[model samples]
Target: MTPDSPASIRPAELAGLDLLASAVVLVDSGGHIVYVNAAAENLLESSLKALARQQLAALFAMPQELEHIVAQAREHKFSDVRQELALERAGREALHVHIIASAMDRPDGAVLIELREIVQQMKQDREERLLDQSQVNKELIRNLAHEIKNPLGGIRGAAQLLEMELPPLHLTQLREYTQVIIKEADRLQTLVDRLLAPHRRPHIVGDVNIHEVLERVRSLILAEFPLGLTIRRDYDASLPEFRGDKEQLIQAVLNIAHNAAHALAARIEQGDAEIVFRTRVARQMTLAKVRYQLALDLHIIDNGPGIPSQIRDRIFYPLVSGRDGGSGLGLTLAQTFVQQHMGVIECESRPGLTDFRILLPLP
Candidate 1:
């Protein structure tokens, strides 16, 4: 192995890089690609063999900026970090990426380049914020539920007593007013119970088939919207089962699908409503700051008017709803359920497409 030869770094040593969620590329002093990790292949939409000996800067729209960073790393033997760089591919959309270039110890002045998608970084940051905010929101809701629960019972009892004390026949007409009060109290009580349900329910863990959960949700959704709505399935049959609460997962998915159905009301009336349930195996996925070798990527997508942008960011927060008269607990409870299983749910929406993606780690 000559000191000037980077060929001394065998493929076996680079195998570890494949496990990383971040894209990595190794460039020799001449700014030619020597090695590319699996994540890099996915990001560049090319294979390692195809990229071997290719100029690293050629893959990016701003080649001169990339080349300058690589040169600086090689000359100073220091690391350089740049943000919001565009990586262009022939048949795909340009990627906004954050690039990190660091000089390696090789005698040939080989440098290590790491690429992270800006959108993905922002998504991860949002997930972390959602998780933290959810904890505080749950606590507030639980306390509020308890407070409301006590008064609800009292209000219902008082209303019942007032009805009983009403005059026999003529005042029976006045009993209707008391009945309304009692009924509204009971309704509020039910809402309070649901607010505290997640904290009160026991997590029943067992081997769960994600497809089964999806099928159950599909049936329930179709049963409700039998005529106009269509539920499509795109299943990856190779996905493995993992430990979780099957019932909780079903309810979680059903809640999201149900919301989509309601959001698609206009299309449903026109007999064009469509909701797709897609399942795929994700490799080297990071969920809740932990990187997993494999994970389940489940998407519930609907072709509707899309979520109103005003409340899109807070959809998972308790009582935040985009639709009129919506209690807003569905997505919040779905997020709580997924979080219990160490998973996270993210959403993307536009004028015609709304997608809710749930990521769950698989053992």
Candidate 2:
């Protein structure tokens, strides 16, 4: 619907758009900005009063395509979505956004526009993919672990019997071979146990202070890298204690911190490696499609060579690692523990920076 005049557009209707997360703007047929919502004001970094009456074309680096879309939208009385538009700002870098223009039912030929950040959209998609992939990986690992576990004990027992029967004479070689088989079987048993650990462990719920958990991990990591590594804490003291398994949380955090410390080997030897444990309360946070009033945002940041690009995307998968001689199960277990507590572990890495963020819903 097109409005014949700007005065005919309803301010109350436009004000309701502020509840949306997407930036919303209304422009008349003359391409003059008529209304801007709170999200738009925040995205544009300009107050509504300052934005009103400005030329809508001025907001975009190249407005020709947007103008054509708006014209088509107005003529067809429908909505049009365009991807990857450069939103120009006065000083800051141009933002990549998806623009949706819909013809408004008004007398002045107004068009309502919605802007969504492309990066944020990609992040949401990534999170969904991670959650889905983790489920499948966990199931596969558990089944494979069980299948390997049953045969391991039989192999170990048979090797022990063979060793006992062969040592009656000068048979050192035979005994040594049996020992190797037994040792290898035992090693396989241990690996299988670790794979099934998350499923076997019981959920021991207790009041969990996130800072306390971080402190435990910090002490353990510092003990291991006593010479050059420094662990820093940035805690939000006002955060309330939540119910979770304390031991599992400790292991989850320790795995990540330990991985970071190992990655900082070069900097640690030079006496300049640092890892920061930061915690804060997130309001109106959503996890796995479930929205919470408040959640705990914990970040484990490190100053080190970033995670290897090849394994960056699949780091949480079992047997995926970046470091030499790495078991690759640390992050898999960490993710399992966090997921048990209804949280997610997300990672971002670049040269000299690797950040692991864990988001858990708070009471």
Candidate 3:
């Protein structure tokens, strides 16, 4: 149907069409919502009649990027598809939305915009990027393990052999130098082993209950840091089993929980440390470009001095850590393992609370 024929269409037909679809809103050049479909009403949690003549910006906190999208649509008659944006719904829940807008062919100058939840889209994007990076990481790890590790082993052996041939006084200094080489070689070898572990190990896929993994991590953390710490679980019993490598999932969850435990040390000592493991089922989840009806949502939350701002962005990168004694491989390994199961890991942190979210597709 032509956009200009709004007057010719019956109100029932328009409302019915909107209710059957996702979210649809028609706004004038002045940013006023001239017409909102039933889906838009439900999505915004506002009635269509009430939304009429109200400024679109008044309904939600529009991100600068989304404002730019609206501006472009008005200025250049731009149309967008699958443009990711964030919106705060009426109930104050921050929603990730994909905004599609097109200039409506009307003399009154209106734009038709559609909103779809973009959490799934973002998950799929992350999964695809991680999977691609995983393949490259696998190759790099294999090459380094074979090429550098083999030569380093030979060098360490040669150092030990040469150390036995030195004179008494010279032997002490020679042994010291040889020991340094061997120690450094050993450290490198350990690093190589970590890098190749995921690829070298066979994935034993099974029905994994996320709660079991969380509980195991909780016990381990409490045992190590048996102070004033509290661990809580908030799991949705209705969540279905997901197919994954059990050992890998355990390691992945443990790594994140361990990081939280470390972050909570001060709070734990003060008897205020709280770490929560929450699980939910996400509907209409999309991972690696494929959509599914259900996905697992696992959140690891901690109340502590939050992650440092400087290292926050690179927390998932290898060798990056916020703590002094941390190996910096926990989050990296956690991310790697989750990605292998076609999942996405994300973090949100502030001064008091830090949350790590793991989204995995369920069978």
Give lDDT per model, in order.
0.90, 0.87, 0.78
Which prediction has the highest TM-score against the true structure?
A: 1
How do the predictions measure up, each by TM-score?
0.89, 0.85, 0.71
Could you report the Cα RMSD, in angstroms, for every candidate shown? 2.6, 3.5, 6.5
Return whichever of 1 and 2 wins on lDDT: 1
lDDT of 3 by residue, 1-363 (tens): 343334433476456555334578877766677677766776787897787777776555655665566777766554553376667765566777778777765565677778876764454566677667756765775786778878888988997888888789898767889899889989888887887787788889888888888888888989998889999889899987778898899999899988888888888879989999999987655665565667998999999888999988678877789989887888888988888898888888999999999989987
lDDT of 1 by residue, 1-363 (tens): 553344767878788999898999998877888888999999888887888788989988989999999888888746575646899867878988999998887778888999999988888888888888989999999999999999889999999998888879856789889989999998899899999999999999999999999999998989999988999999999999999999999999999999999999999999999999999998888888889888999999999999888888888888888888999999999999999998889999998999999999999
Candidate 1 clashing pairs, residues 3+ apart or interchain: none
Q: Enumerate residue pairs that collide in model 3.
A: none
Q: Which lDDT tens digits does candidate 2 get at residues 1-363? A: 335344566667766686666688888888788888877888888987887778877778888878887888888645575646889977889998888888877766788888888987788788889999999999999999988988888989998887777746747868888889998998888888899999999999999999989989988998889999999899999999999999999999999999999999999989999999999998655577676768999999999999988989899999998888888899999999998888888999999899999999999
Ranking by lDDT: 1, 2, 3
Better of 2 and 3 by lDDT: 2
Q: Which is superior by TM-score, 1 or 2?
A: 1
